[model samples]
Target: MSNTAQELKAEILRLTRDYSALVHRANRAGTENSVPFEPGKTTVPYAGRVFDQDEVEAAVGATLDFWLTLGPEGEAFERELAGFLGVKHSLLVNSGSSANLIAIAALTTHKLPANRRVQPGDEVITVAAGFPTTVAPILQVGAVPVFIDNDPATGNARVEQLEAAFSPGKTKAVMMAHALGNPFDLSSVLEFCRRHDLWLIEDNCDALGCTYSMPIARANALGIIENSPGIPANGTHVTRYTGTWGDISTQSFYPPHHLTMGEGGAVNLVSRPPLKTYAASFRDWGRDCWCASGKDDTCGKRFNWKLGELPRGYDHKYIYSHLGYNLKPLDPQAAIGRQQLKKLPAFIEARKRNWEVLREGLAEFADKFDFTLPTHATGWTPEGFTWDATGCRTECSWFGFMLRVKPGAGFTHTDLARHLESKKIGNRMFFGGNLLRQPVFVQLRKDRPSSFRVLGAMPGADEIMERALFLGTYPGLTTTMLEYELQVIRDFVRQA
Candidate 1:
C-alpha cells in the first residue's frame, strides 16, 4: 500500500468517529452523552448494544482492510478475551449456540480417554430452567442430558440434586450455565464433578466477568493453583473468573450480551492446552490440522504421518477428524470485540451498579417480590449481602435484575408484565423457564423415552416459569430511565 492509501484510511477513520459521535449518542454508555428521556413514554429496552466511536472506528478500520475472514483481528480478540478470563484459549465462533456446539463436540473427539469421552449413550447433566442451546448441544452431540431442578432464589442449578441425576457409569459430564450472571454453586458443583471424575463445562455466555471464590484449602483440593491474572490473592481464598473454574466454557458477544460484536461468541479452553487443539478443529470445519486461518503448520511437518488409513502425507489440511461445522465469525466483528474488551471493566461495574440501583429502589416491596441472590448469599441489606456458613462467595456481573412475584401477591407475573409493557418499561422472563416444558423437549420425550432423564418434579422450575421476571441491568440504561421503571412498578403495586 502507498502512503496515499494510508493517509486516506486515517482520514476516513477520523470522519467515522465524528459521524458516530453525532449519530450514536443514544447508544453510548449511560451518562456518556445525554439522550432525552420521558416518563412512561420513551421505550426502555431490556438489553442492547452500548458502544461509542471506539467500536465504530475499529469496525470501520477492519472493514477498510478487507480481510473479511477470521484473520489478524480475530486472533487478537481471541487472545485478549482468553487473557481476560485467564483461560488457555478462546476460539471465536458465529454465535453462542455454535460455541456451545463446538465445546460439546470437542469432548466427543476420539483423542479423549474412552471413559471420559462423551459417547452416544453417555449422559451430561444440566439444569432444567435455562436457555435451550445449553442443553440442545448435548443432544446434538448424541449425549443424553439429565435434567436437575434450579433454585428459584438464585436462578441456578440445585446442586444438591446432582447425585440423584448422575448415573455411575453413564454420566460423563456436568454442563450448566451461570444463570443471569450469578455464578452457580461452583463449590458444590466442582466437588461433585471431582468425586465422580466428570468433566465440567460452564455455559458462561451470560457471565463473562463474574468471579467465584472458595477457601484456599478447598480450591487447592480442586487443583486450582493461582488467581486469575489481575485478581489479587487475599491469602484466604482462590478467586478466579467463572469461565476459568471449569474445563471448558462458552461466551456470547451478541448485541444483547455483556458485549457486542454484532454476532459472535467463543469457546474457552480453561485448563487444558489439548482442548484448544480439539476445540479449534471443531470450529474450523473438523479438519485435523491446527493451522490458523491464512497460516501454515505450527506443527513443523504438516505432511508428517498418516492416520485413519489415509495415504501417507495426505494434505494434512484435508484430513477430517470430527463431524464439525464452520462457526468462525468475521475479522471486522472481532475488531469491534477488541474495542469492547477494552471497556469491559467499566461495563462490568456499570452492570453491578445498575442492579444495585434497581434493588435498592424496589426494596420497599420486598413483601410482594422475591429477588435473586448470588450463590451462597443468604440475605441482602443496604449495607451488603449475608453469606452462608460455607466459605464460597460470588461477585456477579449481573445480566439482569430478576424478581419473583410472590404467590398471592394480589397479581400474577403476567399482570405485572402487562402493566410494565403498558408503561413501556421492558422486562423478560427467565429464559425458556423450565426448558423441559417447552414443545421440543416434550416431543423428544415422546419420541425417545431414553434420550433424557428428569430427577424430580422440578417445583422450583415451575415457580420460575410462573412467577419470575427480570428487568435490564445492561450498561446502556440511564438513571432517569431506571427511575421511571421504578416509579411505574411502585405505582402498579400500590394500585394492586
Candidate 2:
C-alpha cells in the first residue's frame, strides 16, 4: 500500500528470479554427462523423478511470483488437464492419497440423497493387492472395505468377483486401479456399476493416458458413447481414458507417478448439473462463494443474500458449503504439471515401447519365469509394465522389472529378491501384500463375519504378491540402466 513497501516487494521479486536462474544453471551444468547403471554399485530405482531444466525453470518461475498457494497456474493446470482427460472439472490436491479421500468424500455429500452417500458401515469393494491409498479412504470415511482377491496373473481384480461383492445389498462403491497400466476389465466393472447402481472410482494415478471401452458420464447422468477412441469427448461405446471414467476419478502427480507436480495429485469429477459441480467447492474450502481464488462476488450480490442463521447481508466468501480440507496443491506443482503434460504422450509411448521390448527379450525365459503379460483387448491402451512369474525370474522395463520366484521354481522370493538387491538391481515388494492382512485391517477383520467379507479366500493373493516385485519403466531410466537390470536377472537365473 505504501511506496516503500511496493519498492521492497519489487526488489524481493528480482532477487527471487535471480536465485531461480542460478539454480537452473547449476542443475544444467551438473547434468552434462550421461550416467551409467552399474550392477551392485548403481541404484536402479523402481521409479525416479524424470525432469529436465525446463521443468525446474517453470517451477521456479512460479515460486518467484510468490503466489505460492493455488493460483493462476493451478487453475490453468486443472483446466488443461481436465480438457486432456475429457472430464468436466479437475481439482489439484496435495497427494494421490488426498485425491482419493476427496473423491470418495465428495460422493458422501448430503447434496446427493442420504442413501447415496457412502454411509458408515456400508461396504466399498476393492482389491487387496492395490496401493493403500486406494482402500484407505474407504475406512477413513467410516465405510467398510470389502476386499476382493485380484487375478494374480494379471494383477487385476477378477471381474467375476464383483457380482459376489455386490450380493445381498453389500456394496456402495467399486474402486480399483488399472493395475500398473494394465486395463482391468473396465467393461465388466462399468456394467456391474450400472446394474448395481454402485459408484465406480478408477484410480488412474499409475495409468494416466490409458483408455478402455466405457461410457463417459455426461451432463444428464447419461453415459454417452464416444465416436473416436483417442479423441477428447465425442458421442458410441467408445474408450473412457483411465482418468475420465469415475463419477470422480483421481490421479497422482507425485514425481514417480505418470506426471510430476512434485507433490501433487488431482480429483476429476463429472457432475450431471453445474449446481452439483459446486459439490467440490466444499472440498476446496467449504465456501458458499464459487469465485476463483483472487476474484470476488461472481454471484453479483456477495453481501445481499441471507444464508443459514447469519445476518441479513453476510459476506458470501466466508459461508461454508461442504465440510472440507485444505488439500490443495501449490501453484509451483501445477507449473511443473503444465510442463509434464507436454511430455506425457511421449512418456506413455516410451512406456509401451519399452514394455514390448522387455516382453520380446524375456520370451526365451518365459518358461523358467512364467511371466504373464497383460492382454489389452481391442480399443484399449496400457500405461505401464506389470508382469508376475512363478520362478527365479527376470523381467525388464525402461527402469525396473520384476523378480518373482514361485515356491515350485526351486527358489524362494526371499532368495531371488536378495540376489537382485545384492547385485544392486533395485526392486520393491508388491504394494501392501494382501492389504487385508496388514495391521490397518486389524479392526476391520474382527467384524469381518458381519460387516465385511473377502469375495474369495486370498491365500493366492498373499502368495503371489509376496512373490512379486515392481520395477520402473519411468522416463528417468536409461538404456544402460535397463540392460544392467536384465543382466542381473539373467545371471541370477542361470545359477538357479
Candidate 3:
C-alpha cells in the first residue's frame, strides 16, 4: 500500500474517534436533566440500547474500512462472543430470528447422522408463550412444533409437561427460551433431553448472562463442568451460563436486547465442531466451503475432491451443502458488537441492580400483584431478600421486572399498564403470551389443524396473557428513573 493510502486511513480513523467523542458529549448533554420524570409526560422506555463513544468509533472505523460484508470484524466479534459465552464457536447472523432459523436448519443438515438429524415432521417441544421466532423456525423447516404450557411466574415452559409432549421417536428436540432472562428449569429440561435423547436449543437472546446450576452428572455430560471464573464449582453441582447448557444457543444484539450492534445476532454452537460447520454453512450461503470470508481452499482438497454428483475439482466454494439462507450480518455491525461486548459485564450488572430495586420496591404490594421471580432448581429459598441456593440455583441478569395482577386485585393488568403509561413509565406484555391465541397461530390451526400439536390446555399461558406485564430493567434506566417508576406503581396500587 502507498504511504498516501496509509496516511488517509490514519486520518479517517482519527476523525472517527473525534466524531465519536463529540457524539458522546452531545448524548450526555442532551440527557442531562433534559426530561425530568413527569407523570403522563416523559416516556420511560421498557428497553433500549445503552452505548457509548467506543461503539460509535468502532462502527465508524469499520465503515472507513468499507468492507461492508461479513469479514474480519465479524470473525473477531464471533471469537470474542464465543470466549464470553465459553462456547466452542459463534456464528454471526442478521437477526436473532435468523439465528433461530439457522440454528434449527443446522440440525437438519445431512452432515448429522439420519438417526440424530431433525427430519421434516420431527417434533420439537417449545413453550406456548414466547417470541414467535422461537417456534417459527420449527415450522419453517417443516418440523412439527409441540407446544407446552408456560409457568406463569417464571414465563418458562412447564417442565412437568415435557414427558406429555414427547413422542417416542417423533420427538427430536426441545427448543425453548430463557424467557425474559429468567432461565427455565435447566435441570429438568436437561434430564428430560438426556433420557429421551433429544436435542436442546436454548433461545438465549433474552438471557445472555443468566447462569444455571446443574447436577454434576448432567453438567459433566454437557461439558459445562469446567469452572467459571469467580463462580465456585464444588459439591454435587456445577454452574454454567444458560446458553451453554443447551446443544445450540442463540443471542440477539438488537437495540432492545442485552447488548446492541444496531441489528445483529449469533448462533452459538456449544456441543461440537460438526454442528458449528453445519451452522456456518447455513449462514454463509450454504457453501460447502469452510473458508472464512475472502479466503479460499481452507480444506486442501477444496478443488481436489467431489461432493455428491459434482465433478472432481469443481470449486468447493461453489458447492451447496444444505439448503440455506444468506443470514450473515455486515462487518460494521459486528464491529459495534465487539465494542458493546466490552461493556456487557457492566450492562449485565446494571440490569440486575435495576431489577432488584424494582423487586424490593414492589415487595410491599406483593398481595396486590404476583411478581415473577427467576426460577431456580430444587431446594432454593429466599433468605431475607436474596434467594438462598440450597441445591441448584439460577443467577439471572434479569431482562425485565415481571408483574402479574392477582385475580382479586382491584386493578387489572390493562388498568395497571395504562396507569404506568399515563405516568410516562413504559411497560410491555410478555411476548406473544399464549401464542396459540395469537392470530397467526389461530389461522395456522384453522387452515391446517394438523400443522402443530398442543399437549394440554395452556392454563398458565392464559393467566400470563391476562395478567402479566413487565417493566424495564435495561442498563439505560437510572436510579431516578427506577425510583419514579416505583412511585408510579405504588401510587396506582395505593389509590386502588
- The numbered model that scores best in lDDT is 1
Prediction-by-prediction clash tally: 0, 4, 0
What is the C-alpha lDDT profile of model 2 across 1-496, one tens digit per residue? 5898668766665665567555544222113244534556877666766666557667767776779888899999988888888787788888988888887877766667765677778888888887899988887777877888877665778777788778546578888876777667765676788877888888877778775544344312436454223455544235556666557788888877777887888888754444234445645676777777788998899989898898978999888767777787788889989988877877776666655555555555654664544533221123444323311111111222443565576666778778878877666766787887787676756755455567768865786676777666766556666777777777777778
For each candidate, what is the lDDT?
A: 0.93, 0.69, 0.85
Q: Which pairs of residues have clashing backbones in candidate 1? A: none
Q: Where's the lowest-lDDT run of ten residues in candidate 2?
A: 390-399
Segments of candidate 3 deviating more than 4 angstroms: 1-18, 22-40, 215-218, 221-224, 229-236, 377-390
Q: What TM-score against the true fold does each predicted structure earn?
A: 0.99, 0.84, 0.94
lDDT of candidate 2? 0.69
Q: Rank the candidates by TM-score, best first.
A: 1, 3, 2
Better of 2 and 3 by TM-score: 3
Minimum summed lDDT over a 10-residue window in model 1 is located at: 32-41
lDDT of 1 by residue, 1-496 (tens): 8999999999999999999989999998888355788777778989999999999999999999999999999999999999998888999999999999998999999999999899998999999999999999999999999999999999999999999888989999999999999999999999999999999999999998999999999999989979998999999999999989989999999898999899999999998899999999998889999988999877777888588999999888889888878999999999999999999999999999999999999999999999999999999999999999899999999999999999978998999999999999889999899999999989998999889999969999999999999999999999988988998999899999
lDDT of 3 at 188: 81
The top-ranked prediction according to TM-score is 1
Error of 3 at 205 (Å): 0.5
